[model samples]
Target chain A: MADELLEVTDLTMRFGGLRAVDALSFVARRGEITAVIGPNGAGKTTVFNCITGFYRPTGGGVLLTHADGARFALQRLPGHRIARRARVARTFQNIRLFAGMTVLENLLVAQHNTLMAATGFGILAVLGLSRYPVAERQAIERAREWLDAIGLTERADDPAGALPYGAQRRLEIARAMCIDPVLLCLDEPAAGLNPRESDELNRLLLRIRADGCSILLIEHDMGVVMRISDHIIVLDHGRKISDGTPEQVRADPHVIAAYLGEGDEDEVPAEEVVA
Target chain B: MKSALRDAVLSALVALRPVPVAIAVAAVFVGRLLLLAWRGRSRAAARHANRAFAERLTQAGKYVAPLLLIVALAVPLSGDRYYLHLGILVMTYVMLGWGLNIVVGLAGLLDLGYVAFYAVGAYSYAIISTTYGLGFWTCLPIAGILAAIWGIMLGFPVLRLRGDYLAIVTLAFGEIIRIVITNWVSLTNGPNGISGIPRPTLFGLKFTPAGGPGSFSDFFHLPPSPTWRAVYLYYVILVLALLTNWVTLRLRRLPLGRAWEALREDEVACRSLGINVTVTKLTAFAIGALFGGFAGAFFATRQAFVSPESFTFIESAIVLSIVVLGGLGSQLGVALAALVMIGGFEVFRALADYRMLVFGAALVLIMVLRPRGLVAGRTPTVALGRKREISAELVAQGRG
Candidate 1:
């Protein structure tokens, strides 16, 4: 039962001759905000995909060891299995809500598989069967709770697509919470947010950590990262260039040159060469 | 088609059957009113839920109440032979529509050769019962097995193909089966069609030979009743239709069902969630075809003949249409769509040559009117206890 929630080791993914993510390793601690930041094609999202099981890695392993010392080989797990089995939940850069369904249904559906287990195939659930009502009530309660938290209770019955961009982002978070994830991975959650919305998002993130949740977020906003992240990992062209606290990363010349823009279009880092 | 409408109207005149479903609906309304009253008296949360319900009631009543009124009108209207038979055909499509809905609509798997499984079931029954002298009851299981197998077989190659291409391949597969059935006369009697196929006896009665012990005529002591056998056929189909509903409702609530909806929304997300999209997709295909096969077998037996003409591409389109019109992933909606489309088409057969034109125009109108279909899906509006209404205050608290 250690505090290390996720461990990624030597993870690499290749596309033709290009290595999208090459030899990257990091440990995300439990109950903390771990920010992965790099320039536009830094393979940050790609790393998230590999760890969450969207893509099979070409090398290395991802071991998600819960507090109980239960090690889940995320590299071995497929995408959906990673979510359900490893309690790993994620949101996409592009919102992917069920367009045809109402907003409430989308969240309820995130808890779809589990409800079946509780309802025993919904035979009881639909029939108002034993303990089925309890589960159904609990699910509604959870969905309602999240909707309230996201300030979407008023629009609960509206189609998910009808929600404003900011609300949709919140709905996605609420939907992910409905799955009751152990580790939540967010890819650019603050990308399109206005200043006020981003501030609200920061509060939400802090509250999430307070409620005993671990978050791994990929962000471009240095202010948000430096303000909220307990740990920061910087990548450049699929390689982990720096891993440390925000202040440490901000101070590192390698990050300044590779990530913060230097005359390095032709220069390779000495540390990368040494490694 | 006019003849079919006549039959339905004449039949209505002959018999006024009690509609159990209509009564059940009325009962539900009464229960809801009582619920609304209980909700109004409770906590503030209950009142909010009640308000939502009151709003929903008005919106739904505008559409549903009219439809119910039309169905009620049919009770007093009887039908003649042709219209009655068309009525039966409409019922068959309801079954097929419901079947296809589970796969295409619910699971979001585009299956083009859906009719192929229907063919498998039909021919399995046709060749098995006629060739081996098996009884109607005996061939049903074999029909289901063969159809399911064909479904799985069709599922494999296309599991890799998606979207429009998947649709064409499936459509091609359905055509391939039909062509084989037409060319291979030795097995299917080719395009000549299988005739003298035995009707399914109730127990051991022969309907044609009226004096037989278990024939409808013998059982009812009616004199050589042709309509009696037809009525029996209708009930058989009704039972099968009910069974299909029960099974689908059961399946959709399972983990497999949830996996299916997930696959439909985002396959990548589904995989991320650890759902095996391949297995989920295939199971849907297999099960959907199984029902299609069951319906096809029943069609073959009821007609007492089999032919490629019955299993056409248009049939698949019609089934798909019903699913779309009903609203995807909504069981009750799909069934309602089937009843309306098939039933409405049959009722307007008096217009004959103009029927398709009118039907086409109506379809266009529907597309414009309720593009989501007549029975657009409505999610269960959640609310506080006994009140059954969503409490705004409660929801706000849930957000964090």
Candidate 2:
């Protein structure tokens, strides 16, 4: 509990009569890669939405314990306040990079709340009287660092949509990083990537973890999940089937049964469970 | 041998024709290039070249402001009173377009009743100047403040609505303002309207022909003509329009401005970025209305009259078209569109009956030819080292 960065206590999200996430509880440890893997309708993403404040949970609470010892009940905050106040940032499954903005601007926009506050919400900035120039220079510096980290400095000026699929995936992660979040939530970061790109994503996640950031990842790629995740949580039918180290979760019979349910093939192949 | 050579040349000419084949071939080539540009280049070299071209355009954009100002200043020296008046009118629309740009273009709010703020400004100035005996300068800021208040009022209801619903409510708001002014006889003089609104004086100096003390003619010791007032009014509006441009340009680079555009691109994304969406929308409305109010006051003084008829839904449509036809986020595009829309139409005034028909056709043609508006590229507010212009077509509307 001392190392727990995020605690989800009996989180439940119900849509009318349907319970998308029912009585889900888990802890994401500080400075480690914790992943949630489940079948398509198993409500893994529903947990992300609730924790990120995108969907107000029908019941239960999400507590985020910052590295500095401050705690925030993320469930009480709005979507924006979750990011601004709780210092938790998330990327979408569908790659929500600002398509019109340049790769560099996409990163700069992530730091918008801070920059706006630095310039006194823009009045002094307009009058040429604010400390905005210094703040802006620092923002650009941070954006450049991310651009370099993602190997996207060459395409920094290009429109984000102009990047190839693999690069866009990395750019989304880089953009979320620009928020300087204590906890980063990435939803299926390697969903469509080839093996090489998937390897690159694993390295990037490892590097981010090395920088003292806790990551809560939701992914389906078994190779990625087994390669990088320190801890794994598996869900089936809106309930947590198993939670443990990757090896433990990989060997669990319940997790295998959840993936290979009723003799119907799901996205996760049964044979890959061994590897 | 001579005949054979001549026959070959003749055959080539016949294949080419005078215009049709040549034009068709040229069109095909250009169409192919545009398709490639729209789809973007697969090769890194082509993208590099495109970036270079866009960067050059951004460099050229730096000089466009000063050049425009110089051209605007030299206009009055031509000594055509009619053109000066026309220039003033064009600048008025330029101000209105820039104001509405903040709302519709930057913030992505489809405000159909922007002219209501303009009306509030004009009426505020008229009532203050005529009844309270205030000067033009004195009433200017008051007019802007009043319109901005109305803008905030409009902002509250439409905060939850977006796109077409927001447009519908704003359109209704415009009609309501006009109707209220028309019915409020004691305050607004009803359909008769308010007239003899005093002209703005140059400090204490009047543009009177009697050549008395404190009159422009006596103070400057120049021959008085009716054109003097028109010329002075031209400069006043020019200054105001330039101020609008200056403030808008500066704001576009600021954090708030960037936030507005970010919200426009994706509201959900903006909220996730920790931006207060309500404050962002309200500021866009208030700032846009502030300029609308300023232009409205200028209109009242310029015409020496005030009436509900001037602030019709058509005025809103005209301002909206100016922003759309110009290209949404391009400041230079808005100004150019105002000229083409307002000033260009003046040239066709002799054909009065067919004037509107031509204007309508022209608008449709422009929209068809350039769906992203005339100036489609947006210069990004933040860049690494060198900025590049982003094609508007590449930008997804992002509601999905």
Candidate 3:
């Protein structure tokens, strides 16, 4: 855990009587892909919300340590403060692209805080006296780079809602990337993709990981989970059931029992371990 | 066979209708031709073509303003007082629409209390000029600042509200302001309002009689006609309107402006991007109110009178309609909408009994045919190559 970018300890979230997330703990290492897989209603998303400050945890802490030795207690911060101050970014399960804005503007808006400061909170910029032009030029360059990586440079001027489903998912990732996040949390980035699109998503995630940004993904596809994840954690009924490297988690009896049938775990075949 | 079928259909229509067969046949032929014409071009293709045309128009935006300004300046040359006053009224509405556009169009705030800011500006000028004896130039900025302060005050409580709830609160705020002014007898003179407000001077020269040494007509060495003041008022409002347009255009390209648009699209997404949603919303209110203040000050000076009756809920509704009917976030659209809506009403003034009915019908037709307004698409603040128009179909409407 020396290079851990995010550490969750005993994170608990209670919605009235229902414990959506209970005592969940995990560490996401920098520059690596960490995936959380669980059955339906296992509260994988609740854990993400706790870490991203969308929901206040009933108990436990979420600690994020940056490369420069700075640390943030994400649980104590507001949602926007978590993203802005802690440099953590996330994509929604349902795509939340700025539908009225163009594909490029959506990415540009992600860098809003940076550009707003450069313009002296818009006073000097509106008057044409600030370094806003320089900042704007840099932002456009960065947006273009991301657009190229996502293969959406041609449709940069088109409205974001007009993009195809696969393209919108990629654009959401790109928009999240534009925030210059230290930890990128994607909620089912592969959710509605075809096999080919999922393969493309895998390549994109790998490239994003290679850029030294840690990725925390919540996905249901086991093929995607086993193929790309460097580390995997499984949860059941808001409890962390298994945590280890891919092979170890894949072979764990608890994970197999949770995936197959809870009582008939003995009937599982040896060959199914690879699945 | 086709002719037989058409004839049969025409005969059937004649039988069912208390109509002549000749008229039915003609109506059927026209309807079929129109349907075929419409079906000939795909909707997607038509939308793309319309967007391209809009793009070209926006590309020429720089020239459009100055050309309009030239025409405005040329209006007083015609020397028609009625037309001149109409132009001034239209310009006032245009300024009001532009101000509200910042809040409703860009920031996506549903503010029904926008006219409250306008009232603040007008009253600020009226009260100060009457009591303190300040000139128009001195009170203009002060009025704007005061209105902006009121804007921030109003913005604070509503920061947590959204959609219809936000709109209801704003509507209440507008009514509250009007009620307070009406009952505030000592300071505001109640329903009677403040009167005998000082008129603006042309560099310390009044537009009054030549008996005064530095009167405007004396300075120009022309016979003093009331048209001098009318023309002066026209130019002043024109300048003020242009300033409003200029500032709004500049802000649209600024970082704060983009934040407003982003917030409009999705507040949760905006906050997730680390944008200060509170500041964004407040600034929209303040800036929008600032312009409303300026326009208000001008209005008071032009009328030389102030009354609570002038600041009503209907004014807020009209301004809101201008922003919506102009297409959200489009400056040229707002101006054009103000002109068409306001100017259209003025042109039908001769048929005073039927004026409101005609106005209502036209508005209904606009809502049905162009629900997105005259110019619905927005040219992106930043883009590569030619900027593309974001179609109104892409936006969630009627909420704000």
Per-residue CA lDDT of model 1 for B1-400, tens digit only, reads 1122223222322232234334433555676577668767785886466556545643664587457536433422453556557656766887887788778766777665678888889888988988889888888888988898888898888887776667778879999999999999888999988986768888877777445665668777778757666666776776777678777766664455655665666666555554567777888888898899999898899888889998877667667767766765556667677777788877887976555545554554554344455554434333332222222221110000
Instruction: State which candidate has the highest DockQ.
Output: 3
Best by TM-score: 3
Residues B255-305 of candidate 2: C-alpha lDDT, one tens digit per residue? 788878788777877776777888989999999999999999999999999
Error of 3 at B327 (Å): 1.2
Q: Rank the candidates by TM-score, best first.
A: 3, 2, 1
Residue B79 of candidate 1: its Cα lDDT?
37
Error of 2 at B3 (Å): 61
True contacts kept of 1: 0.28
Clashing pairs in 2: none
What fraction of the correct interface contacts does each predicted structure contain?
0.28, 0.69, 0.78
TM-score of each: 0.79, 0.88, 0.89
How high is the lDDT of residue B70 in model 1?
61
Better of 1 and 3 by TM-score: 3
Kindly report which residue stretches of model 1 are placed more than 4 angstroms away from their true locations once superposed: A1-3, A119-131, A264-275, B1-79, B131-138, B183-189, B203-206, B209-211, B245-259, B325-400
